[model samples]
Target: MRRIEKNSLGAALMMALLCSCSGRTTSEPFVQSVSLTRPIALNRETSHLYSGIVKAAHEVSLGFKTAGQIARIHVSEGDYVQQGQLLAELDDADYQLAVDALQIQYDQLKDEVERTKQLFNQKSVSANDFEKASAGLRQLGVQLQANRNKLDYTKLYAPTNGYIQTVNFSPAEMVDAGTALFTLLDVSRLEVEVSIPANEYLRRDQFTGFTCRAAGLKNGVQLRLGSITPKADGNQLYHLTLAFAGQPDRRLTAGMNVEVGITVADTTRTGGFGVPPGAVFLDGEVPCVWVFGADSTIERRPVALREMDNEGRVVVIDGLTGGERIVRAGVSALEEGEKVRVVETPSQTNAGGLL
Candidate 1:
């Protein structure tokens, strides 16, 4: 009987140790301590990022002035060309023969006219015959000039310095006069194209100097504002173009994408606030925040954000006015009307505060 009593005592101590190890907590209500800070006003000026495309300053298509078979093409697509450089040529066999025949006829007419003039001096030929021959010669001369111009039209030359963008005709293909046989892009200057909303477009005049950074560039380059379209596009956006202020980056080619930034100052927006990202939480799609009431209680307040500022803080545009205390953290656990205390340090010790 004494041994059984000792075993029961050992069992009781084991139960007590197990209960202590379980780490049970009291089912009691608690208050959470949170740090409070109010939002401040924003700057009068703001900057925005927009998608832009790099474009050639000028693009042109070149073709022959007269129609014929393309006999030779000296430049291909992507070839660099200089002003007055010969790009392509047409078969001049027919044009040459026409010129030769016309020249011979003109010469013959001239000889006849000369002989007629001599005869007229001697009274051997009538005045009517001499005048008719002279008229024929003069008409043939005009025809000769017209054929010569057509012959010169056989060769195509570049009007300006640029790179060939496209070649539309082959050496053996027949094309009409004025057909676009080659496309050239002027790369001496580069421009960036961006679209902006109408409201921003109205204030484009107030935009300060612009800057742009392309995909492969280590730094951004200053850009000069070119022109803003007076008319709006179908999407209600105005297209604006900015030219490179200095020599553009060599790696930046046409059709390349870039991020363009423009700063605008709006005096009407003199008052706003910046809040930490953690202080705001998404209530579905809308952002909401917990504000510490004057009575030390917490209430959820919906807020509107303008944009992310340079310091990584959200610019609160419309929401609570200035001088409203907000909980810095522990927002997810707090409920509406829950009494809380403002703590100097943001820490995890706010889990069990004054009840």
Candidate 2:
């Protein structure tokens, strides 16, 4: 009976040993399907940001110099006019009649003065009589000149070349002296006025490379800084003036709201690897990137990021060395030290080429 017991114990021991070996050998590798790329080096990435519209520089208001009843309106709102061009005509009939009357009186006074002078020269009239005739001529001439000016004022002319924005008085409307006849905008040159907060002005050099964009500019257009106003606004906003690179099309007009972006600085670093924005996942507050090893093993490494560019790529600032294989796609489904099959997509190949 003792011999039988020993044989049973030996069999049990052999079975247990085989089971342990099988357990160790049958365990599968943690296979994770992913895409990978080398980590980019610094000095190979650029930073980009966005901002709002800047208006053109020069603007003026056109007002009537003299008061009169509007007889005709020569131009309407949005009409372009040249300097000294007639903008409107008042009730010039009365003014013309007054001028005509003054001309007639002046002519008569001149004739009388000429006759008086002749008489005085021939001793047919006293010096006092000749002086009276001369004085009458001078007084009439002054009055006639005043009347002529009133007539000329009846016509409204543009002070400068610009687009007419507002026409306050319509035909037959009584406009008073110095009334606003038109609001002209000089769009020949436009200025983009932006108010940068005090904090932004601290880096005064950042204002150098900004671009201004309106509704239609998707590709982005460049803007040049015209001036930085020294004084702040009521809210302590520093006003910045940016001039357009070239004359914008007529479609761009004054008072049109736009988006502007000031280039803070050139942060294009070299040898830095970029990944699709989707691939960047946060492990707590720390930025962590996944890299695939040569044997399809995944390793999670911390990375420093500088800024995101306009192209939707995140810049790998540091904590990553160049030419290190990193998981480019399917980063969200990765675990530390997991075995991954690096599936090279067309985009992934292109990204590899870029580095």
Top candidate on lDDT is 1
Candidate 2's residue-wise lDDT over 1-355, tens digit each?
Answer: 9999999999999999999999987895556677666654434323344344545466676655677898888898888888888988888888889889989988988988898889899999999999888988898889888888888888878777788878776788888888877788776687777777786777676445767667776655567888888888898888778787876756677787777776565344334666667667889898888876777677888888867754567888677767677777667777887877767666655876675
lDDT of 1 by residue, 270-355 (tens): 45788888899887898888988778888889987776765677777878888888887768888889998777753465645542
Worst 10 residues of 2 by lDDT: 41-50
Model 1 residue 11 distance off true place after TM-score fit, in angstroms: 26
Candidate 1 — worst ten consecutive residues by lDDT sum?
Answer: 346-355
Best model per TM-score: 1
> TM-scores across all candidates?
0.60, 0.59
Report every candidate's CA lDDT: 0.87, 0.75
List ranges where model 1 is wrong by over 4 Å: 1-44, 105-141, 231-234, 269-355
